[model samples]
Target: MLSTEADSHANQSDDYAVAPARAWFAFVMIFLLMLSDYIDRQIVVSLFPHLKEEWGLSDKQLGALVSVISVVVAVGSLPVAMMADRFGRVKSIVVMASVWSMATIACVFARNYSQLFAARAVVGLGETGYGAAGSALVNGLFPKRWHSTLLGAFFAASAQGAVLGVILGGVIADHWGWRAAFGAVGFPGLMMALLFMLVPDYKNVVVRFAPKVQSKSPKAFVKRLYAALTHGPTLLWVCLAGAFELILVSTIWAWMPSFFNRFHGMDVTDAAKHAALVVLCCAVGALFWGWVADRLSQRSPRNKLLAMCVLTLLTFAVFTYAFTAHLEVSTQYALILLGSFLMTCSVGVTTSTVLNVTHPGLRATGSAVLALFQNLFGLAVGPLFGGIISDAWGLDVALAAIPSIAILSAICFWKASRSYEADMALVAAVLRQEAAGERVENTAVLPPLTAAQA
Candidate 1:
């Protein structure tokens, strides 16, 4: 019996080998999971017209609903990261999907803006956990060589989901009403969580179904979290870059539809159609950038994120012009596509850079921290801030502010590359010492090294 059980386990391990087929399957799953988040986010914006009409919401009130959701997602990111590190990625996904599924379903009950806002906030909590855990899982599953490519594929799915959510929600709202649209998209997400159960877990180069036990306690988790934040310039810079990127991305997602609807005097369907084109362009851009990053990484890892900085600056200009320009429908379509492609292209680069420098065991924690900062500044500040600006200065002037933010993000990302190179050396050295069975002290601090370190 014991021998037969051992043979069964051996066969299972053998099946876990990195076949191309399996890798592609894992990529598909990651893409699907990412799509879920995009649907959740995009659905709200698509339904905004119906909801505004039904509830008679002011711009300020609607802004509050979006802001509250961002705040919860930002706050939830850190704790979720810690949970991911202490537990496992799969478990985190399970809990997050369940929580968000319920929160989304609860949206059906909310007749007022405040009630709906509260439900959205709860949804944010689940989304945060899912984002951190899912990203880490993708990193762990794929080889280092293709990390950017795989993650880029995942990011591209976000654009696809956005397109689907906007088109589907808008069509449904036109026909059925807003509540059914929410339940229709939100309920399927719960099933995706269940599907996650079939996926294997990756830990220390082994794939297993059972949760791997962690030696670290909650106290240690906190300690490590502090150490990571306070002791690492690379991590700080990367997180800052993420925050900046999110700001631009979030602003675009939250308000671009409104921008089109109001500025072009188009109905929800027409606005969504344009937005769908933008989303498709973004998806294409994401995949292209991922391919570029993976190719460039063979020469220098820094190229991964450096490319992002350059593209972001370009995107800032394109987006600003797209929103501010008073052009014909054809011209408008061209500008939106150009802007989206440039903006989303950077996703693969930025995500790969973060994952590459992060400590192996703390991938999820680090991702969480990045997500938190990004959400706080990007999601929280960008959309609401943009709305306020639109309210005060008009949409054109307010949107001009997006390029400035994007430029700032570009600068931060560029600066982060230098610090990241240095940190990679330090981490590599620490790992080397550990391999030698040396109990190296001062894990938090390392003196400066020559260019060789970089």
Candidate 2:
């Protein structure tokens, strides 16, 4: 009987393999849902000029519309992700997608700034849980070797969605009206949410190798949450690095259309088209850099962190040149494209780092914690602060200054590299023990690394 049970365990471990078609299908569905999430969240940015002109709003007010969503998403991600961990990820994602889609459609009916603001907040509420849960689900479907590549590709959906949102919002708003843009992008998410219900989850496919201990008590839940949050010192530095990098990312996504319109004298649609191209570059960069990081990590894990740090520094330099150099319009666009591409290289790598250092059960919550810090410190503040600075000086000055945050981000990533190997080994040890049917107590705490290890 013991031999049979052991054989079953080994077979279950092998059952991690899924049909390529099914895996890709699930990937596409989740990717589309994520794409829709960003489309709903970011469509407002493309409407900034329209809203500003119609309402006679200031840049700060326009920026606040974007910031409000990030603020709410930052606050809501933790609880919503916990729900995903406890309940079902797929069901949670469907509900989330529906809520955001409905909220986005509600934007079409909003009559005043207050109404629109509330609608945007609801959109945030729906989106806060999706990324973390979606990433966790995708991770479970594939082997760890593919984590960075797949997650990088998965996260690239954000840039792709943002590109579509800005472009479609601009084109539709130009032809039909800004309100029509909202309804156009919002409805597809509802359908996508329903379609997502058909995809299978990891629990259904993979039989449990280790005993499943679903934490029923609040105390056990708290302990798990705490462990997830403090899994390693590397988590803190990675989150901080990602947060700092996002300041630049958020600023660009939020204001690139305005920047083109103001500086290049392009129309709304034209500006959006150009910005969409830049965002496409960002998507490509995420995949390219993620692949590069994974390859480098195969050589040595420390190389992954080094790659992020180097990419960030390069991004900063290119962006500084793009904004500060008094160059031709074509040259500026080329530089912006290069800068945008480099800026996203860290996204997949950082996400993979967080997942690798934490326990499997805490994957969604771990992602949520990363999102919480990234949104709160980066997304919430970047655009608003940039807008305020733009109002005081000029948008050009704001763009120039924002890239400097990459310097800090690079430093944090470099620091993280120093501790990453030790933390990774610790996580591996714990996972191995768990695989052998040992319960790991205080799994979050690792023994201090000796000088030799360092």
Candidate 3:
């Protein structure tokens, strides 16, 4: 019996050790796709001044253009994620990338406000499921212990994409034209979609979620989703925390270029350059914090949750000072960079938390739920609310006030910390049962366990 157990452990270890080269290559390809995804989504923001001048648009209208995508993405995420779960993740990703790429190309032909808005909505439709499905796919490719660090790096691609979008969009718009920026950024995703087909699927890759459910029915999917959302007290609070964080993040991403252009008297290109630097700082922060969370989580899951709560408060304080203080331009920029970095620290941690408590069958759906809250409350409302406030008072006042939502976020994350360990243990119990060759339903409910018991 001892030899048998040792052999089992050795085989598992060998499996993990054999697949580094192919696994990392697939990871890089998927990471690049995510990078392209954000570039297409964010490129429009860099053209805000040009769009406002040419279209005679109001701040509300410009903000609406950004918010509408989030609204669509929020509305579409669940259904599309379900489709990915029912269908194949690789196939769904290819199709999604293709659709969004085409929609972005359609932006080049948009002659007026309505046409552009419609195109952007379609872009959102194509993008709605990509994040959830992509993350789920990444989870299947990497070891469980690496989820936070790798997903953090994966998600950090958004910041890099944003940086590229703002900087390259501004430069391209200046040199070629705003329409050219759309075409230039949009075409790469299509080629990447083709390249993605060559990467191995979950079966070939050998890194798969243990004890996965094989259900595919819509009813089963819905039930699994419901189970995932209600699996523990922590999921809802974590989702809410993420939503609030995105509220601050979306506002910054949507408005910072304009903030610099207006307040610092920089040209559009120069303003985007500065904003890009701040976003790069955010990317670095996401990776740093994710790595920190992974290391701390090695000691206890509560440590990562506590870290998120603390970072939220820190983010709020720094951002408030950046916006409200009458500091010098350089000083304010420094503060904004600091605040942006702190604000993103929770990205990977929250994602890993959700996945930790969720069943493998529902990970994509779980991710979609988080995205739904984030988009509906954070992405959809944050920018539009800021726009309204800016119209009422000024842009600076709007930024300062909007980020105070982080206080609520900190509260939610803190509350979640209380229940996280127990919930994780519950998930582990279910996975263990399934690994023991017992048939497990998606909606199987396990009795609660206390933290001490866990």
Candidate 4:
């Protein structure tokens, strides 16, 4: 018996030894995909001024482009998410990446605002699949213990992508025109997508709460989607949080270049440079939040989410003051940088929180629900609302919405925090019951996926 136990331990060690390399490879691939997604999204923002000038478009028209994409993304995320669960994550990622990249490249050939708008919508549809599929793949690739931390790294890549788009897009647009900028950013993602096919699915080794569960048929898929949308606090809270946050984030990213150029007396390229730096700071904040949350989870599972609530509350003040203040250009820049960084910390916090609370089998579905809220509320409304406010009430008034949204988000997260401890207790009880060979009802209330014996 002792010899058998020693052999089991040796085999477990051998299995675990391959995890680090797998985790790194998965992290790099997901990071690049996320980076590409953000870069694609940011291209519109960076080129807005040129597009507005060349096409003689109004703020409302630009707003429509933003709105249409978000709406499409929201609508597309669900079916794509279901498809991911039903079909295959690797296939979903490849297809989604190809579609979005090709669609974005099409933007270079668009002759009218309508054409561009349609292309952007297609890009959104592609993104819905990309996000859900990539996230599910990431969860499967990492050791269960490292999901949040690796996810944080993945989130950081997105921020880096945004920053690169702002900085590099500006330079590219200035040197070769906005169309070239789009073409350059869009084409590279296709290569990344192709490379992704080389990575095999690691879902087999990664423990899941529903390990033997098979994908639902289309009818069951639709039913599950509906159930997620209609019957749970999970969807509601995620949507609210995503909406408010996206609105603030998108609004700022989409229009900040124009705002800086107009208000600070800077050029487009210069504004882009500044925006890049600010976004880099946000990336740092996001990464830090993830690390902190993961460490905190060791002591209390709720610590991850609780940290987010605290950041949101604090950042609200920072954003309010930054937007409302009248200071020197340098001072204003510093304030904006600091405020945006603090606010972005919530990205990692919210993502990990949502993932942690959701059932393993429902990861793709949960991600879809989040995509809907994020796109509709955050992406669609945030930028368009900011633009409208800027047109009618001035940029200052428009940006004020960010702080208000942040405050509301803080409140919601705080309420969610109250339930975290109880949720943890329930999960622990379920895990214990399962260990004792008793049946557990709700799959969501189980121990962390990694802790389960396969």
Per-model TM values vs. the true structure: 0.86, 0.89, 0.89, 0.85
Query: What's the residue-level lDDT of 401 in candidate 3?
Result: 95
By lDDT, who's the top model here? Answer: 2
Per-residue lDDT of model 1, residues 71-145, tens digit only = 887888877766665666777787787777778889888878778888988888788766666777677666566
Model 2 local distance difference test score? 0.82
Better of 3 and 4 by TM-score: 3
lDDT of 3 by residue, 1-454 (tens): 0000001121112243227787788789889998988899888888999999999988888888788889998999987886776666778889999989999999999999999999999989988988888887767667767788988999899999989999998999999989999999888999998888877656311112223445445565444445544468888899899999999998999899999998889999999999999899989999999999989988988999998989999999999998888899889989999998999998888888887777665567778888888888888887788888888899989998998999999999999999999998876776667557554432233233323332
Q: Please give the lDDT score at residue 371 for candidate 4.
A: 75
User: What's the lDDT for residue 58 in model 1?
Assistant: 62
Q: Count the backbone clashes (under 3 Å) in each candidate.
A: 1, 0, 0, 3
Q: lDDT, candidate 2, residue 441?
A: 35
Residue-level lDDT tens digits of model 2 in 1-454: 0000011121113234466677678899999997998888888888988998888878888888888888998999978887776667888899999999999999999888889989998998889878888887777777677788989999999999999999999999999999999999999999999999987666521112122334345565444444534456898899999999999999999999999999889999999999999999999999999999989998898899998888899999999998999999999889999999999998898888887776565677778888888899988888899889999999999999899999999999999999888887876766667566664432222223223322
TM-score of 2: 0.89
lDDT against the true structure, each candidate: 0.69, 0.82, 0.81, 0.69
